[model samples]
Target: MEENHRLQVIEEGPYADPGRYRRLVGRLVYLTVTCPDLTYVIHILAQFLKKPQVKHWEAALRVVHYLKGCPGQGILLTANTDLTLSSYCDADYQTCPRTRRSLSGYVILLGGSPIAWKIKKQKTVSLSSAEAEYRAMRYTTGELKWEHELLSYFGVRHDTAIPLFCDNQAALHIAANPFFHERTKHIDADCHFVRDALKAGLIATFKIHTSNQVADIFTKSLGGPPFSYLLRKLGIRDLHALT
Candidate 1:
């Protein structure tokens, strides 16, 4: 884990026991609910449940060891911060070797602190990166709406549209504009929910450059500096560790 670790199913190793692997990874899936740093690796391991190999098992064990290194690190929600809702969404276009499907990830922040995050493979293959990114935007909007409703029950009404940050300008434009054209014809009708969310004045899509896109960490493997950068941004602090 000290290195920029990425996971792939290693077939040359002996087959691993499915029961143990599933149990271990199942727990990690729940851990990912609050531990966004482990999202990408744990999600990769979950795919091989039926026919896990030695390398896959080893990778999962490595994750267990990594957990020991920072059991106390987690998101800290303070009451003093603002209640504004913002989100960052990103995708790894066609990075899944087996299905050739892209990965979509989004992070929801409450008052500049991360409250929720998730990453998973797209259900269908996307023909373009823009399409993949657009799909992620739609999902982000959905999460925003759900959170908005929950906050409304508490009498916290946001007078402004929630900001959904995305790195693809084409995807941003597609969500903001009502025009229909040949380039976006292949995208499914359901994916166009982003447009509806925009039209309703419930969401605002904005372009952010990749370097500052914190959601980028959730979708792909990152080096030490980049990973550390995101960890800091997510407010993940090792409270007792030495600086």
Candidate 2:
């Protein structure tokens, strides 16, 4: 997807064949398992499956062209023996052109290799970027907790807090502070577990610079340079690329 291009639902337009578009998007969906770079664009394309337009078909084909450039591109988990777990979470505030819903995304890494990732739209409109980021932190905390327990079940001991990095300072403050202020009252009460996880030593919140926020690739469309940079940060590679 183009970084500046935003897809909108057009009620009356030259529509593409829904069947073909749906099948193409489905194959793209499966590609996401090995192509983190495709996650955001495919999510956008999947939205108009029922009423795809020619523009949408073009966008889908753009992804196919991208794949043609490097068919062997895929994530490469390192063989490092460290059992450390860390996560990066981020949110693109109100990016959906039609619904004004925020998109939240996170990537969980085990021993510096990504093992789980997700991108989702917030259920309710966030009145502030901090709230949207806080919600993303909460969702990531839940996943961290589950991952922690799963590792423990297999006798992996993680004595230290799992570091959860976010680019928003306000969200980091909210996650570290236990008290609820009037400004934070609008956020869902359930999201407070991010703070709980902090106190329970299950996770620790850290402030990261936006440029270093690798999870940005999952939440929004990025240009080629930054996209390739973050993809390299994830340890993804093309094993068959010419040397």
Candidate 3:
């Protein structure tokens, strides 16, 4: 999907074949297991499966065209022994025009190799960008906690606080600060789940510049150069590409 493009519910416009669109999106869902880059786009297209518009189908086909260009492009799991877990979490505030909901995403890496990721629409509308980002952090923290426990099962223990990177300073403050503020009064208590995790030393929130935020690729559409740059940062590669 292009950065400028936004998919929405088109009620009056010409619609596409629903069956075809659903099938394509269904297959794309499977591709996401190995193609983390396609996760966001597929998540967006899947929302319109029941009543897809022409624009939606076109976007789906565009994804197919992109896959054809580099069918072998995929994540590169390194052989390095470093088992540290790090994560990047982000949100696109009010990205859904119809519902005014935000898009949240996170990528979890194990020793520079992506082990898990997720892109989801917030269940409730967030009044502020900080709230949206904080919600995303909470989600990422839950997954991070689960992954942390799972590693212990495999006899891999991390004694230090795992880093959770975010571009929003306000959200980080919310997690680190124990007191509530006027602006954050409306945010649900559960949204501060990351704060508890922080107190327990399960994770540490770090400020990352938006430009270096690799999770941006999972939250919103981006232009070509930055997209490729982040893809490389994600440890994705095309080993079979012709020289």
Candidate 4:
């Protein structure tokens, strides 16, 4: 296995070639199937593949190094868990330096294990953090519905509303209050799917503090300590402990 630092190429180069870089990124995308930790990093690196400069290659290599250090890390599912379904969602409002589009990410858990997750750039640029988060909640609700249906196929049933945790109090308030139309009139209609779901009793939204926002891991980069903390909270355990 390669060390984390060794994976990065420090030397500067204009290396305008993209063929090799594309192949490398393609391989990384394939690895994301069983290695969810690399999904965000790999998605970010894939954006720079068209003009593969030294910086882009260095970032991709860093992911390779990180993977090498924790090759045994992966999600684990246990038997005899509860039927409770819950999710955490978040967004980085206008985080894209170029287009200013927000990035939406969420993780859905069945009992104690994460069964589905996603991280993607929003289709539209949101005017405020509250709006961005609301949009993310909508996307997450759509995913939750799909998961609910899939579980039904297997005879697993959840009678109660699926709870979605969001760190933004303002967003949670907006979803719960129907009279806040004056404030939210500017937001896209599609982004209001969460509110509609709330009305139908399909899902429930709750406010969570920043410290407990597990979905933060998918939306932005974090220092080693906080990152590891959330990873463990998501049910990712050290391979040695399981053995």
Model 1 bad stretches (over 4 Å):
1-9, 188-191
Relative to the unseen true structure, what is the C-alpha lDDT of residue 40 in candidate 2, on a scale of 0 to 100? Answer: 87
> What overall lDDT goes with each candidate model?
0.83, 0.86, 0.90, 0.80
Tell me the spans in candidate 4 whose CA falls farther than 4 Å from its real position. 1-13, 241-243
Ranking by lDDT: 3, 2, 1, 4
Listed in order, each prediction's TM-score against the native is 0.92, 0.95, 0.95, 0.90
Clashing pairs in model 4?
A: none
Cα lDDT, model 2, residue 89: 97
Q: Is candidate 2 or candidate 3 better by lDDT?
A: 3
Worst lDDT run of 10 residues, candidate 4, spans: 1-10
TM-score between candidate 4 and the true structure: 0.90
TM-score, structure 3 vs. true: 0.95
lDDT of 1 by residue, 80-111 (tens): 98899999999989987777899999999989
- Which pairs clash in model 2? none
Of 3 and 4, the candidate ahead on lDDT is 3
Cα RMSDs of all predictions?
2.1, 1.5, 1.5, 3.9
